[model samples]
Target: MKARIYVTLKEGVLDPAGKAVVGGVHALGYSEVSEVRIGKFFEMELKDSSDGERIREMCGQLLANPVIEDFRIELGNS
Candidate 1:
């Protein structure tokens, strides 16, 4: 099986990198972009152990920092 993990900053957390991107976009004349939020995407292959519950646990334990970020897992066919 395959798993895709997305990790992002929490709502109240400050994202300097995202802010920088937004500024850069604006500077490049893309004014339509009102905001930007940067995050991480990880793709991995797993064996039979790749269950939803286990993937969620992995996100909470290692893929993300629960205190300042949130994560979502997408499962894919083997």
Candidate 2:
């Protein structure tokens, strides 16, 4: 099984990288792109597909910063 995790900043958190990207887009004349946010994506191969708790634990423990970030997990066949 493949477990994919998406890590993103929580609401109300400061995102300098996101701001820089948005500014750069505007500078490049893409004014239509008014907002930009950055995040992380992780993929892991698991021996047991049913062991979802392990994946969740990994995300909570290391994959994402709990204080300022949130993560979503998706499971599927590799």
Report lDDT (CA) for all predictions. Answer: 0.88, 0.90
lDDT of 2 by residue, 1-78 (tens): 889999999999988999999999999999999777799999888887368987799789998999999999999996
Write model 1 residue lDDT over 1-78, tens digit each, in one string.
Answer: 899889999998988988999999999999999888999999988895657897789889998999999988889874
TM-score top scorer: 2
RMSD of each: 1.3, 1.2
